[model samples]
Target chain A: MADWLSPAEWEAVRLSLRVAFWATLFTLPLGVFVAFALARWRFPGREALNILVHLPLIMPPVVTGYLLLLAFGARGPIGGFLDSAFGFTFAFRWTGAALASGVMAFPFMVRAVRLSIEAVDPRLEQAAATLGASRPWVFLTVTLPLILPGIIAGTVLAFAKGMGEFGATITFVSNIPGETRTIPLAIDLLLETPGGERAAARLAGLSILLAALALVLSEWVSRRVAARVGGR
Target chain B: MLEVSLRHAFAGFTLDAQFRAPPGVTVLFGRSGSGKTTIVNAVAGLLSPDEGRIASGDWVLLDTDRGVRLRPHRRRLGYIFQEGRLFPHLTVRQNLAYGTWFAPKGAPREDMGRVVEMLGIGPLLHRRPAALSGGEKQRVAIGRALLSAPRLILADEPLAALDEARKAEILPYFERLRDEVSVPILYVSHSASEVARLATTVVAIEGGRVIAQGPAAEVLGDPAILPAGAREAGAVLTARVAAHHDDGLTELDAGGIPLFLPRVALAPGSLLRVRIAAHDVILSRERPEGLSALNILPGRVQDVRPGDGPGAIVALDTAAGRVLARITRRSAEALGLRAGMDVHAVVKTVSVAAADIGTSGAG
Candidate 1:
């Protein structure tokens, strides 16, 4: 894998893939949960939860990364608790990059999933309840299957967004080789130096190829789910 | 028996109703906004009423005074909606099995093959709901509801969305369920003919109140309590197929008295319930010798009830059953028709449409 590209470029690509994969995989479940609650459940603090879930999307990505650092830094409350209780820290680490990407990608995934949940007919759920299924079983057997295509779409969007995440990842975990230096950060570094345009162009092309592949994969998966569940 | 008493207040309407449905098909009959669906929803726990005590047999479903309320899933009622809300993502086979998964493990298992054969939906098991016709979807909906092994069945105008042919197609299956299965049903409908064909007991709703409640024969025999007055009044008569003539006439023995109608397709000895509209019959004092009407039921008038208009509904206790005749007050005055007068009720042979005839019990 290192024969075609320089070692530094290869390291950046590998780290970016690792960060995006873990970020998207971890956020999928929580994204779906928040989406279902926002679309269906009504309680005293529902709107407050809605605004909280969407806060990162509306705020600037650099500000979001700073807030993450404040809450999860080594001396921060949560970071210090983890350092004493679990002996772990996320500051200036690859894990911090993943967390930053996931936070930046949360709203995209949730909004897609929420729209699908809202499109489902509540009467069908009522019919299921009358057939003797409890609320959770009704969601598992009927509602979940129907919204699968949307979930897949949201997952792919979050993954792509994570791969291109520059502002938050660079802000939270300072650029470093083989750890925090993802594709976008590496491209920024290469462009700032003289006689590094060729390396930067190759990395930029790789970014386009990776994003296009993600979209194609997403389309294929969503098509399969739609065929399984769509009435059309 | 299923007992329901509920009170609900809407913006401009108030629904206060009470009725007891014995084992059979009990129809909630009324106009569109008379709160028939509201009562059914309350019984199914779809909507919470302001105050209510709903019970089926000894099993209490809802009691506001006792602070006891069961959710819809725990109640185990099978509801058939007007639109036949089958899950579009599931095949017909899975839709039928969905309820069985949630049904009690030791409960009586409804035979899938029997229900499949009954509704003739075996061929459609692999197809999605989007591929089914309106009638076919409803047939599967009925099969799905039955396979749930429900304690009670609630049908909210299950046939209202279909055409006349489809209604005719589904009515027999409902009759089959009522006769073959002992589960009590609360059926909602505004069609007088549907009530005439399906109901064993009738509870007529008007202005969110139960105006009358009794056996189907007794309620349907009275024209004044009918929602549409004389225009929609009809009598349901139980009869037996006596013979089929070569001249395209089917003769029925109505309580040991032979009555003729257009050719019925049933074989001899088949029990049938037929609805005779009140406006279709004419009354005469003396036996008319040269009359073309084939049905001449000789019975003494039980009573004559005058309507709000110039018409009158005469309740006649024929040997067949209670029959109603809608006639003008001028004609009643001219004929001097009164109680205890023996008169021949004349009925046209073609007046009984094919939609009005239904088989009585299990085939």
Candidate 2:
């Protein structure tokens, strides 16, 4: 294990896991709300909302990072307000890295959850209302369970994307060691050092293993939920 | 009791309906796309009508004039849709329990065991809805509604999706619910046979209007009210089994008339309702001899209605009750039959098949 991961590499791996986990956790509930709105609700700016959600997917990663920095930088309006209200800072910090990763991975999460919400039968919701269940109760008991497989799929995909986020994280947080240096940042640093080809290879292998494990776990969880819910 | 008076226009069709339903099953009889479902949905609080007043007992469910529109859950009305609509994730027990969870705290608990036994769902409690047959799923759906302790039960063609055998299997359960449960029921159906067998009060709806409303027998027997007039028109008779004969016949005493039918397994003194189809009755100008038909009742022509096709509906009032006979125009012309004419109505004992007989009163 020591040969597989040096002390500095292990720290990077642990920090990357923490950032990915926090990013997925913070984005899931908002993702579900946005997905539901996109799937079921009709409004004046629905098309505009769809385009805005998909902008992160089409825009260059560095451009997205620059936009995030402009909006959430220390001197920016939102960043200044947040710092004053909560005594928090995002410029060149681990939290900034997490914010950038979450923004980059949000589109993937929203699309998966949106498709699942659309696939649910609306008639079932109407039936629940006729059975004396209110709208919220119907969603909790019927619609949520029916779309749980999709939620898990979206979560895993977002986590995997967060784990590999590089351009946005490095651009926003400036690759500070023992602070914002994630697995991708560490691998980049190793590639630039002298006689560091073997270290870069090791980090690359570790990233591949983590990504494969995330894929297998997602498949297993989604299949188990689908089987339990009696997939339509 | 239920009172609904409403008017609404949708797309190109206009719905103007008003009716009163007393205790027992009041059926909204009409064809498909005739606003039958719309009325029920309005009462269930799923659809808010433009101008309407709905009241059940003293509770005002909806009153546009008074600015009251109760939510669907607050209405406390149970609705059994065409499809069973069982929660896919819940087992039979869970589905039944889900209904009871929302019931008012002070409301009496409808016995879950009794509902299970009534619906014959005891063996299916642990099973998911996906594993049950269509008929079984419908039964569970009914049981779920009952456990909620609703003020009224609205069933929209509950048996429309089932096959003949499954329909036969579930019809008895609905009959029992109508008789045994104290709650009033509003049933919707287009099948004349189902209305004949189950309805206590029949509301004839055509073109989004209540054309006629009265007792099932009176409404179904009226030649002018029913579209089929004489050919498919029938009168519902409530009778009691008097005896079973060894010669393959069952004796029934309805009102004051002794009616004989083919062999049926009901014991003596058991109440039954029989639907005598109008086309099966042969009207004779007099009591003729050498007739092969076993049953003959002497009566007078109460009315005469000419049908659109080739037949004429003749209403005969016997000592028992009113009976309808469908006779062709040729026979009517040859016999010179008209209103107030005395006649003998002949019915073949074998024509009254066991399937046409219901074991409960008009409910």
Candidate 3:
């Protein structure tokens, strides 16, 4: 698959897949937890948390990236604490690109998960509780399995969004060939350079194909899991 | 005994009820919007009343005075919902074992094989809940609840969602649960036939208040507490399925008198509860010769309660059991019927709808 593309183009594709995979993997647990809290809990600041989580979706991607940079930049409080304490950083690094992609995709994942969680009949949870399953057990044994398809769909959406993330990634960790450049970032560079349109078009096509593949794979997986749980 | 005293007020309704139900099928019999479901939910710890005290014999589940309220899971009650809320994602086998899987370490688990056989759901073990019929779903729900090793079982009109045939199919399982299982059940129902068939203790509720509470026979035979008045009043009699004749007639011995009703699919000598509707009974001054009715129970009238309507309810101490006959006030006056009058109560064989017959809860 890499032989046909220029080394630079191939790197872009590889980097994008890695970033998206990491982004999706890291976003899932937090997304599910937040979605469940928003759907089923009645805590204070819930609406505020909801608005904050959704702000990225409504805000300009560059603005969200700027916000991320201020909080996670090398000299930033959280970044300085992390660098001094944990000795890790997300400033202009590949991790920063992944982090930007995750922030951009967080709301989409949460929305899908929250919708599915709300769709679950509370009576079923009540039934599980009456059958001697505590809250966490009810979630693990009933609610989680019931909402598997939704979680998968949300994951795939996040992954696809991650692959194409350009504005946030560029603003947070500027485009570098290997360090932070992904499919869209590489395509942007190729479009602007002298006689690089062909390579850019190829990369664009690759992004579309990858996204389509992710969607098809997620659909197939969701259907199979749904059938097991009798969701249909 | 399960003791409940709860008071909850809603926008336009209030529920203030108190009752002590002995260990059996204690049915909260009432019409819709009468707080039957609310009472059960309170007992199950699903709903917290404004103030209430609930105890299962020595185990105090909730007491607002002490600020003690156990969570629904910690209360260990099996609640069978009217809609059969089986886990849709689970196969029949998984749904049946779901409760038992979480049953506390020391809680006696109901045998999975026994539950599967009891509900006749072996063939459906691999199927999802969506594929089961309404009756089949309810049966599985019952199994799911029983296998939970619940300290108490709460059924909120478990059969209300089914059609007549489906209700009949599931009624026997509840009867078996009442008789065979040692756990007490708190059942809620608006149907008089279901209350008559299964309730060992009946608490009649109206407008969120328990108008009457006593043994099934006592509460069900009272016309005043009966929601539909005298029309819905019926007497429950314990009978033995004496024999099944070739002519599709099952002979049942109620007390010492033999009653020939439509054939019931029970082995001879099995316990059966026959609910004789008061309106279906005709009181005669003497045994009439060549009468076509299959049952002529000879008994003296205990008392006659005249209603504002032209109808009167005559309580009789027949050899079979305590039978009730609904005769017109004019008929009572014409026959000079009184407390000591000897009257033969005649019941037609076909008048007993098959739905009125149920398995006896004698245990």
Candidate with maximal DockQ:
1
Which tens-of-lDDT digit does each residue in A1-232 have in candidate 1?
4677799999999999999999999899999999998998888899999898889889888998888888888988887898899988788888899999999899999999999999999999999999999999999999999999889999998999889998888888889888899999999999998998999999999999999998999899889778778654
Candidate 1, superposed: residue stretches over 4 Å from native? none
Candidate 1 residue pairs in backbone clash? none
Cα RMSD for candidates in order: 2.0, 2.1, 2.3
On DockQ, who's better, 1 or 2? 1
Q: Higher-lDDT candidate among 1 and 2?
A: 1
lDDT ranking from best candidate downward = 1, 3, 2
| lDDT, model 1, position B267 | 98
TM-score ranking from best to worst? 1, 2, 3
For B195-288, candidate 3 gives per-residue lDDT tens digits of 8899999999999999999988877766556654677778888899999999999999888899999999899988888889999999899788
State the local distance difference test value for candidate 3. Answer: 0.90
User: Per-residue lDDT of B1-363 in model 1, one digit per residue for the tens?
Assistant: 889999989899999999999888999999899999999999999999999999976799999999978999999888999999999999999988888999999888679999999999999999989989999999999888888989889999999999999998998899899888878889999988888888889999999899999988899997668864578899998999999999999999999889898888889999988899999999998988988888988888988988889999998988988999999999988999998999888889899888788878721
Candidate 1's docking class is medium
DockQ leaderboard ranking: 1, 3, 2
Q: How many pairs of residues collide in each model?
A: 0, 0, 1
lDDT of 2 by residue, B186-274 (tens): 99988777887788899988888898998888898787787433446877777889999989889988776788999777899988888
Docking class of 3: medium
Relative to the real complex, the DockQ score for model 1 comes to: 0.75
